[model samples]
Target: MKLHGTVPVMLLPFRADESIDEAPFRKQVDFAIEAGAVAVCAPGFATEFYKLSDPERYWVAKTLVEQTARRVPAFVSTGCGSAHATIEFSQYAESMGADGLMVVAPKWCALGVKELTAFYEAVCRSVKIPVMLQDADFTGAGLPAKLFVELAERCPNFRFAKLEVLLPGSKCAEIIHLSGGKLQVLYGLGGVAMMDGLAHGATGMIPGSALVEVYAKIFRLYGAGQVDQARALFHRLLPYLVFALQHLELAVGIEKRVLYRRGVFPSDRLREPTLHLDNDYQKQMDELVDAVIGLVNEVKAATATRG
Candidate 1:
């Protein structure tokens, strides 16, 4: 089966003193699985990947693979500025039994298509598992449709692409059409455009892990042809989704805080220099969740019925 559905970009839990809180992090993974996520991904942007050291990065990947233990696919972001480090991390993830890898374009300098393609080709060549290109405008090196097509055609392992752009539905559709459905497309942006992306032929989504059950409901409802129901749920989720995307750098902190509020995370403490919402924003998020409680319960009923 393809790696599909609400694959959460997990948040790394932290202790009061800023240490990695391993226990809560693992439980967060279990919570996502119990909530019906088709796969679990970690050390993505939401996981504070940039803040993690080399050893910490490997530990997160290792822990995710071990905890998931094949319950669902496990993917880790292994992109680095140089091909050698990328390959090293990619191979390490494969060694640790990761199901696949998500790689963004090399950073610090914008390179031409030829250099970008060569970078991806090198990483794909070094690993046997599938590789996903993370196409995000924030990366300053978003893959154009043509370059994406070339990567798909040139690398057999290049089988998935996750788009993090505005108005992603058309881009999602174009990728699906241009790649002949050979490359499965997913969208991010806290799933604000999830329904639109799905309608445009995205196979699935990879949103933050705060409310995996809700996202799972949307994905399952849509796939089951309950289009109207899915749209309703997606709209219900927009308040929090909008809040989550308010600041690009603060997205992970917002997710961690929500998870903490939901009791899925031990604490919302993040590494230094991350944002923390004040009481006002917290009250807003609380109200948003309150408004959606009924819909959330309805999703539970719907999921049980479908099962």
Candidate 2:
């Protein structure tokens, strides 16, 4: 399956004790597919993959693949601290029937181009499935576009790039231009830069799952030549996105809360060492979720009618 359109980076639902909440997690998978997600991804930054142990990571991957059940493509994030661990996770995801893998460069220590290239080459070569390089530079300095072109030329499975920089439009255009047509770009950062990224030739976006229906509608409108409609719809979502993306931990908390409000998740519990939304923040989030709930419902009802 081709990795394109709105693929949500899933939020792992947890119980009060921080154990994985299996039932609601399954509901989330079904919800994404029902809401028109082209694919589903998990254990990314938003999923709090850092907090998960190795066994928990594998379990999340396996459960996601199983819940998705090939209804649509499922992509798993397999970026680990070392190349060896990353390859191991990538192969495990592939073995569990994931359609693609999204790999983030190990962020514990910065690696030069040579080291980064070698790391990616090894992982891509180890898996037959398509690998998406996540250039997630939250600090505003992103990987050079030429590195992506170089990796594409070297590794057959290195086919996609996910741009999560401060402003990703130019980088998205540059990577596409440099690679000629070999690489497909997917914008992240909770789809905050989605319209700009789409205008710059991004194939899709990997946004948080709470509002997958709304995002999917925007993508379809853009693809159908309804640029004005798409822009207008995306503008309605801009405020909430800007608010949630202020901090990664804050974003995870907000997404899980929205999912809970929408009745997809039973609880909006984040693991310890996480940011807690104060009373003021909670009120603001509730207002934001209220502002868009109707729009989300309208989109879903329309989709169901069309189907």
**Number of the predicted model whose TM-score against the real structure is largest:** 2
Superposed on all Cα atoms, model 1 deviates from the true structure by an RMSD in Å of 2.0
Q: What is the C-alpha RMSD of each candidate to the true structure, in Å?
A: 2.0, 1.3
Model 1: per-residue lDDT, tens digit, 1-307? Answer: 4966888888898887888999989999998998878888878888888888999999999999999989999998998778999999999999999999999877689788899889998899999999989886743336777778888898899999989876777777788889898999888777777888888998778888877888887877788899998898788888777876888666776677678877888777889887667899778866766555556677788778978
Candidate 2 residue-wise lDDT, 79-183, digit = tens: 999999999999999999999999998989979999999999999999999999999898785888989999999998898999988778888899999999789
Output the TM-score of candidate 2. Answer: 0.97
TM per candidate: 0.93, 0.97
Provide the lDDT at 248 for model 1: 62
For model 1, the stretches where C-alpha displacement exceeds 4 angstroms are 138-141, 292-295, 301-307
